[model samples]
Target: MTPMLKHFRYLSTSGIPRPFRSIPGPLSLPLIGTLYKYFPVIGNYKFSKLHINGMKKYKQFGPVVKEEIVPGVNIVWLFDPKDIENMFRCEGKYPKRRSHLALEKYRLDRPNVYNTGGLLPTNGPEWWRLRKIFQKGLSSPLAVQQFIPGTDDIVTEFIERLSLIEGQNAIDFLPEISRLFLEMMCLSVFDIRMDSFSDNELYKNSRSTRLLKSALTTNSCILKLDNGPQLWRYFETPLYRKMKKAQKYMEEVAIDLLSLKMSIFKDRDENSSKSLLDVYFSYPELDFKDIIGITCDFLLAGMDTTSYTTSFLLYHLAINPRAQENLHKESVRLLPEWNSPVTKEVLAEAQYAKACLKESHRLRPISVGVGRVLDQTAVFSGYEVPEQTVIVTQNQVSCRLEQYFPRPNDFVPERWLKDTPLYRQGHPFLLLPFGHGARSCIARRLADQNMLILLIKLSRNYKIEWKGGRIDTKSLLINKPDGPILLKFERYQC
Candidate 1:
């Protein structure tokens, strides 16, 4: 029997779907809700082990779990693909989801520096407006295609740098990948090469390192404040203060980059094609502060998402030699020579490469899942959920379950390819790496192009091997690798 048929054999959706109240989850008290369940000694769940906790919840609750995470704020977690589809379908024209409350508070506290809470936190009309402008040049395939040459240029330089440390015992590639993504994002968003890979004393203390450090600091701070109590809301907590300092540095750097780009725009020929930054600048709806906010948002969003995803992708390739060889075969077929320029046409034929990425995403998604606050009421698993209720889709859990993908724990890229016998025609919403719908990731195309080009180039050059312990994820607002990504890179011989 086929994997799809096998998947069907495990199906147990019997009887009528339970009501909203019947959705199983941990107990919730009046003021603290289910917050006590995560407290020390008394609590069963650990905030650091949220990903593990999600798996435990799935086993206990059987797909649909609802809990009031905080007082008066109830969240319905959907692990079933069918219910995930229902949740998204209920998302109206302006799909709304809860943002980083701490980040929003930070932005709102400083009205002069930020016009809105940026893209990740803002909702309603402001989000719609920003998203529309963001989609102008960043969303389209062709738009990202324009940067293929530039992205490949950065990747080629990075691969050459990797060659220097080829024979190292175990290379901690997370930092290496982080630097590569930073350079790529700089070239794509700012139309400038950060040259972060260059071994220069000046580069060490320059804007690139500073910006990356600030971003990391801010991410750590936000994670600490978001998961815990609302202590930051009451006063400037130490972590909050540190985040503000890092954010302040980020704001200064963004304004500087904006100024630099604007000055360059003044002298450039009108016939020259506009860059992503130029496209944002052209939008009259946004002012200077808004541009700064958007630039900062892109910087923050681009850094970790693609870099972390690439790290896991490489890890998957490292441990699974068979899969890596298959990818190497695909890369060798398309890229005849090392440092071959990755063009839009070449990427079109790299199906296996794309499948490898999809498989990696299935295993190590950047976030546990995407969440939404529906505009209208919807029925999920026959439960009549109310409007404006936050519905979090447990995609991380579902994607790994046998019910959706057969041999879900194994790294098998063939499952994503239709011609393979191992393929399962699973639910369309089973794997949402870039998410779905209008309110999905704004830089989805750009991130994909960036990583695809890098993967193709890397596979053609080196055979990745992992000789370390299993790397898992730790939830930090978003999912991040729990430990260092240690790998060995040996130059491939023809």
Candidate 2:
């Protein structure tokens, strides 16, 4: 029998609707279907980058296409901004992300230990409650503004730390940026600096850093399971053991930190200072384990995404000297001092710098797209998508289209300057790396301020020159630099 015949033979009677199947994609094979689309060989690499592969299929199949990660698991991919907006509006009260099966399983396996799955997994009333409990802290504008000075101090110290490198050799900058971002996040979240380099023994290479590492590693392990079959859950795989062990370590550390904070909260004056930690502590009803889980979630999300985005931003500025020079000119014209405490007022004045960052986000979003698991049926691309289906905004793909961006791949921050047609005509939904609506990233404000501050300080002090090969990216959820991000930064003469 032919391959198409064999596939149809095995396909369930009500499998995929004929109309839906006709949307656009490669020929679905006997059993693997469009899985071959993911593995199309290019040079030496094969199926290594999922999002890039998705884009190739998007080009083949029109704006809306269908791809399967595995057999029987069908997903509708969207590239239109209008469809993304519709999908966002259709996300009911408690929007679910395509739920992380491994993370949810980890929570369920330790039900007593994790009574309420934190913000990422839980939905319905449970998610609503969890979100309400922490949103004020995680999404607070005031908290972000308050954090600026402290984070600025860290950014400065990080720049200075970079100078200590002995040679002109290319720096493997990812870990350095990760460490600095973690320190800032620690100070913001726990009101404690999580630094690797410190004068005091207690502060140097802190336990919090270790716990954060474990959390990230465990998350990576869990996501690995997510990409593969479900048989790992039944088997005692080494990977599973390591993840569970890391999870346990994270829980223990969280309990210890909670006790320490609780002890301090009793004697400490309420007006001492405000922080994300203070906000979490205010909700005493929240379980200790869940708080730890949320902390881990925030650390993992907060550290890498912001740092990698900033790194990629610098990569662009490095390659485009004109953008960097323009940004510096803006900063010099707008601010009295580059190293001073960053305020909202300063951020406002650095509009062009902000635009440059926005341009980078448009060109190279950390995540290729964002999704919401629908709660109600919605019509999209002339199809009636069912309830509980995952609707993704291919933001990366949408933002890159020439029809929308007019030379999409090129880095042109000027297009973002006011009075430009591209600036006036672009829809807000065209490039949402963070996401949109009430379900958007809680740390958006924090991420923005962090990037803006880094851009200002880095542009002020150094000339970023790209010493790396082609800038390539890989994503589990948030994309990170796939190759060595080698750059040369010469101190500014001015």
For every candidate in turn, the CA RMSD to the true structure comes to 5.3, 6.7
- Which structure among the candidates has the greatest lDDT? 1
Evaluate all candidate structures by whole-model CA lDDT and list the values in order. 0.83, 0.72
Q: What would the per-residue lDDT of candidate 1 be over residues 346-442, giving only the tens digit for each residue?
A: 9999999999999989998978888899776666766667789999898988888987788989999999899989877889897897779988888
The CA lDDT at 486 in model 1 is 90
- Model 2 agreement with the true structure over 133-195: per-residue lDDT tens digits: 777875666667888888888988877876876236688776667777778877777777655
Predicted structure 2, TM vs. truth: 0.88
Model 2: pairs clashing at backbone N, Cα or C within 3 Å: none
* lDDT at position 245, candidate 2: 77
Q: What is the TM-score of each candidate against the true structure?
A: 0.93, 0.88
Please list the residue runs of candidate 1 whose C-alpha ends up more than 4 Å from where it truly belongs after superposition.
1-19, 40-42, 201-205
